[model samples]
Target chain A: MSTIDVNGTAVEVDEEGYLVDLGSWTPEIGTALAKGDDCELTDNHWEVINFLREYYEEYQIAPAVRVLTKAIGKKLGKDKGNSKYLYELFPYGPAKQACKYAGLPKPTGCV
Target chain B: MSDVKKFLYVNRKQPYGTIYALESLEVVLIGAAFEQDVSLAFVDDGVYQLTKGQDPSGIGMKNFSPTYTALGDYDINKIYVEKESLEARGLTIDDLQHLTWEDEDEDWAEKDSIRVVSASEMAEIMDQQDIVLSF
Candidate 1:
């Protein structure tokens, strides 16, 4: 376990940098997480991050990349749903990197 | 279809108080990528997994019951709930969450994923599977 400072408060995260307690997540923490990777959270990035948060709220499990892509196409738009679009937003891997910023555990079946 | 094997996941435990139910769901999601013909059987105490309004927050555990609703998006639509198990637990089909999938072959018509089956019918389903994974 490791800690990241969010607004002077230490937040516990796993070795993989995922939040140890999901409820501790906040938009500021998400921005801090993205900054650690030197990736800035733009409106585009926040869109996917917010989507992931809502997805987790309803399903209680982070979706695998394939499922996430298809679902994004349905809820967002086809133009923004493809892996190319998502990958461009998070070069490290859409489900992995985006889920990290969204404070969701690594997506199920990701590995 | 010749290359696709029929896989059956037999769940016989309660949703909580054990890890089997959660492990089974994870396996099913991972296995869905293989595009096999998959079916889930909820027998014995497993019937409790599908019951509606599961609140595990009180137990300090993640409430994963809602994750079952995502099964439809994974193309796993064949969910069989044992009639005997539900009756033994004093639950009816209405007590479970309603799950459905879109039928692409039928112009994307939404179809129910859960089917209540008798023990004998469930046995027949098991006999038809090429692979049976117990959880």
Candidate 2:
């Protein structure tokens, strides 16, 4: 089984490897994670983060990178969909880093 | 450090074209690996991620949707879909695999416990979440 420590919180992994306690998260925790990564939360970051939260509430799963970009494009307009723009905001990788900062689990199929 | 936190993922794009879906899933899995609570929501064309019968081999890309099944391995359950999104895309609950469906007709009085919701309702969910990330 795999496990990770978030803000010193030791979380257990399930059989499929996902976390079991989603109700415990808070925005402040997400901000702390982003700060640890040297990222400054901005309005743009909030846009993506807010979007992901809503998405998860409805679907209960994470979106892959491809879907994330297209959705960003559609919602924020095409100018924001391009990889260049997304990468600029999340240098460590938009989908990966942003989801982490948002306090969500790591996305699937990532190395 | 005290406890794992809830993290929401919003998917709104198509299945292919970029690394949005793939990368987002990676983050979700990683979060789960760390013991954080994670959930996913599909809206707009993002719903395509759950569509059945995908064939990415022709395009030279791996069939990424298969990763959806792997999500359970990470314990990152709690997948959701927007009712309007499914209807707009002409997809039904049967078209999707490996997820719990929330019909549009379900109760929404509590707001937080709702599964299927309208676009606006989905937005409201985002607002209430401590952290929201859109992929």
Candidate 3:
């Protein structure tokens, strides 16, 4: 486990940079974490982060890329629903990186 | 730690019933990061892992089978789907996902990822591996 400073408050993050305790998450922490990954939090990124957080709250797990893409397509417009666009926003992976910024657990099943 | 070795991940269990199939795939993805010679062999009930149009919502499970399509991006595209196993389960190549990858060395030509092989041929492949992890 490692710690990062968010508004001068130290918060623990896992080795993969996901929040150790999801309850410790905040917009400031998400911004700080995205900065560490060389990303800026645009409205597009928040759209994904918010969706992931809501999905995790409902399913108790972050979805893999396929499920995420399908759900995004059904809820958001198809224009913002494809993996290419999601990958463009996260670069690393939509499921992994976006969930990390959303303070969700690293999705375990085949991600 | 970059000592390149041949890794054969033998998957013989059915998907969804147990965690073995999904967990084995997790190892495959991590193994990809090591840049080793990785090949996956689907034998016995494991052939169901790649069956297309799997909807797990009725059982309250998330379908992660599509992750197999991205294996090529990790440079782990050599997959042997045993014909005997599929036949035993009354299936054919058409029942599975059409997985493909681009061959950059060959003018970016699209190539199939799954190769159907006989059980005996798979035995020969298993014999050639340096490290075999069967699930």
Candidate 4:
């Protein structure tokens, strides 16, 4: 059994290393996740975080990078949906970081 | 505002031609900064984004595929590819670089971490998103 202290709260990890109670997550918890992981959330981080939360609600899952690009292009206009713009903002992994900030469970199958 | 929001970025364009692919990446990156939850679905020609070994130098374009590797730094890891799209395009997980396989020696399966679904499944995902941005 592995345990992670999130925002001073001890969270027990299951055998699979997933959170036992995913619902207990919150934005504050996400902030903690970023901090614990040493990721810095910049002004641009908000757009993807908000987008992921809404995306999860509709599909109950996180969108992969390719799909994310196309979707953003359609809604926010084509200019803001390309990979170059996305890399500039997240510079890491938009889906992973955004999911964490959205308080959603870590996306399955990510390394 | 209006509580946390959800967005679905639908990628449908080719890797080059237009700026659609790059623009979509920006929204997801910025959207995450805003604390929004984001997911992505690739359909039609959009599947090309996941293809591997792309050398854009001949066209005088930078190699954009490498940027996909940076998604983890930002924590945006959710990635999906339509199974049918892969088949239709004669693409397999092996054709793509970043994706992992269960067998590591075989084709992508349903159990693969990437959500490879049908057109209808993609549509369902779109309808559920608070905002569906297509490129």
TM-score of chain B of each: 0.98, 0.80, 0.95, 0.80
Screening candidate 1 with a backbone cut-off below 3 angstroms (N, C-alpha, C), the clashing residue pairs are: none
Q: Candidate 4 i-RMS (Å)? A: 11.4
How does chain A of candidate 3 score by TM-score against the true chain A?
A: 0.95
For model 1, residues B13-112, the per-residue Cα lDDT tens digits are 9988999999999999889878899999999999999999999988998788999999988899999999999999899999999999988689679999
Candidate 1's docking class is medium
- Model 1 has a DockQ score of 0.72
Q: Kindly give the number of clashing pairs for every candidate.
A: 0, 64, 0, 82
Worst 10 residues of 4 chain A by lDDT: A12-21
Q: What fraction of the correct interface contacts does each predicted structure contain?
A: 0.75, 0.17, 0.04, 0.00
Q: Please list the residue runs of candidate 1 whose C-alpha ends up more than 4 Å from where it truly belongs after superposition.
A: none
Q: Which ranges of candidate 4 are over 4 A from the true structure?
A: A1-111, B99-113
Where model 2 places Cα greater than 4 Å from the true spot, the runs are: A1-111, B100-115
What is candidate 4's CAPRI-style docking category based on DockQ?
incorrect
Candidates 3 and 4, the one with greater DockQ = 3
| Candidate 2 per-residue C-alpha lDDT over B42-132 given as tens digits, one digit per residue, 9 for 90 to 100 | 8988889888788888999867676676464345556778999999988887788654222224531212222566788777767766678
> Looking at model 2, how many pairs of residues clash?
64
Q: Pick the candidate with the highest TM-score.
A: 1
Which digits, one per residue and each the tens of the lDDT, describe model 2 over residues A1-111? 655566687654444433456666677666666766678899998899888777565445556666577668767988998788889999988877887766566655456
Error of 3 at A55 (Å): 16
Task: Find the candidate with the highest DockQ and give its number.
Answer: 1
Question: What tens-digit string does per-residue lDDT give for candidate 1 at A1-111?
Answer: 799888899889888888888888889999988888899899999999999999989988888888889888878989998999999999999999999999999988777
RMSD, every candidate, angstroms: 1.8, 18.0, 8.3, 17.7
- The worst-scoring run of ten residues by lDDT in candidate 4 chain B lies at B101-110
